[model samples]
Target: MNKGNEMAGPEKEILDGIATRSVYALGANAASTRYCFRVLRRFLGEGDVLELGPAEGLMTGLLQSTGRRITCVEGAEAFCLSLSARFPEVEVVQALFEEYRPDRQFGTIVMGHVLEHVEDPVAILKLAKGWLAPGGKLFAAVPNARSLHRQAGVIMGVLEAENALNDMDRRHGHRRVFDPESFRQAFLGAGLSIDFFGGYFLKPVSSGQIEANWSDAMLDAFMVLGERYPDIAGEIYVLASRPAP
Candidate 1:
């Protein structure tokens, strides 16, 4: 059995609490996967799309509906198998994104929370450049280690570290974290140009579904504040394009 697929005691406990206290939040975790896809559809008209690190295929279903040829590359065997079973029409490649490459070029490349975990972000971006056709876009998302929640948690002694959103000592720890400027530089060095980038969801992960009723108002306030001070947003979404000229 793949060890990563198995939930550890702490993770199981958290999931149990989430399921009991708020199924909506449990569901929202998967639902949030769609937000990036909406942004992708606007850019990718009618061509192939590449999705790296498609964990458990949460976003695969949404991409399938776009009518574009979708290729999902997953590192974990369990997730690849699950994704293949769910979307037979969609091509699922059971390989690490670092090793796998499609035969054809793509109009769009999508990845979420996959960058910081990789050993070499720049190398991966460079590799992805080959798969993109001219003017195609690469979309990526990751947690902001400098977010308000992380900062407050550090000061209040609620959390231990601020550099990485997740615990790195754990087997599943993220390898690196990025501020907007650093993140942009990584792509720039890879020959990709930034087309769009922004931070979002300026809230703590612990807040959960309890905020659902008032989240809109709360997020509005936080977003305004984050606009003035982006270090507070919990996560970021970025779009980089392969230069046409």
Candidate 2:
């Protein structure tokens, strides 16, 4: 539920409306999230962790496993309430990223699958940069515009272009799809240095297509395959830090 600060009235309602729906818990999506955590785990920072748009706490649950004092900031009240009840140890704050004013910096900040949903990805990244403790890292992942599935969609005439949003994108309230170049530029634009940039989940088709036809073994295999071909991976990630003074 990442949104611009200018969002108001109907726009706010629209985002909240999308939040009430259970999308991430689905079969393929759930598997993707697990794989996302596997990639995130390698670069997770020590001490406190700040997670943005945790949704149903799938990633929140994973972050808690590290025992790093988790705090989640989600804009949707329904999600905030659900997260609080589900993870009593977690501190869930219900507020938009633009309005959230944390009193202290954090060791790690995660924005898994969040940038594409926001109205201003660069602005959000800049905001996150300001909240990082010295040497802390910001980890963000977004759907790749050049993913095999997306490229296939364009070739199959299901999408207008590689960067075009599909049915799932609209349903999930995604504003844009990011390719490798644009994804890297967002971090650079935020004045952060790239510590690591790679991707995971080498999805060859749509989530629906995979869920209907693929086996768990096949799914697991592709999850790791993306590391070798990150440019076209289903999801890409960047680990960034503040430049040296």
> All candidates: CA RMSD in angstroms?
6.3, 2.6
- lDDT for each residue of candidate 1 in 1-245, tens digit (9 for 90 to 100): 11233334553443333223322113334434455555456666557888887766667778888787888876655566767788888888765566575789888888877787677899999999889887778988776777776777788887777764444213334567777777888899999888877766565544444255555556456544544555566667678877766
Quick one: best TM-score, which candidate?
2
Q: What is the alpha-carbon lDDT of model 1 when measured against the actual structure?
A: 0.67
What stretches of model 1 exceed 4 Å from their correct place? 1-28, 165-172, 204-231
lDDT of each: 0.67, 0.89
lDDT by residue for model 2 (1-245), tens? 32224536665676688787759878888998899999899988777999998988899999999988988988777788789899999988777788888878999999998999998999999999999999899999999999999999889988999999888889888999999999999999999999999988999988988999999999999989988899999999999999999
lDDT of 1 at 227: 40
Residue 10 Cα positional deviation in candidate 2, in Å, after optimal superposition: 3.7
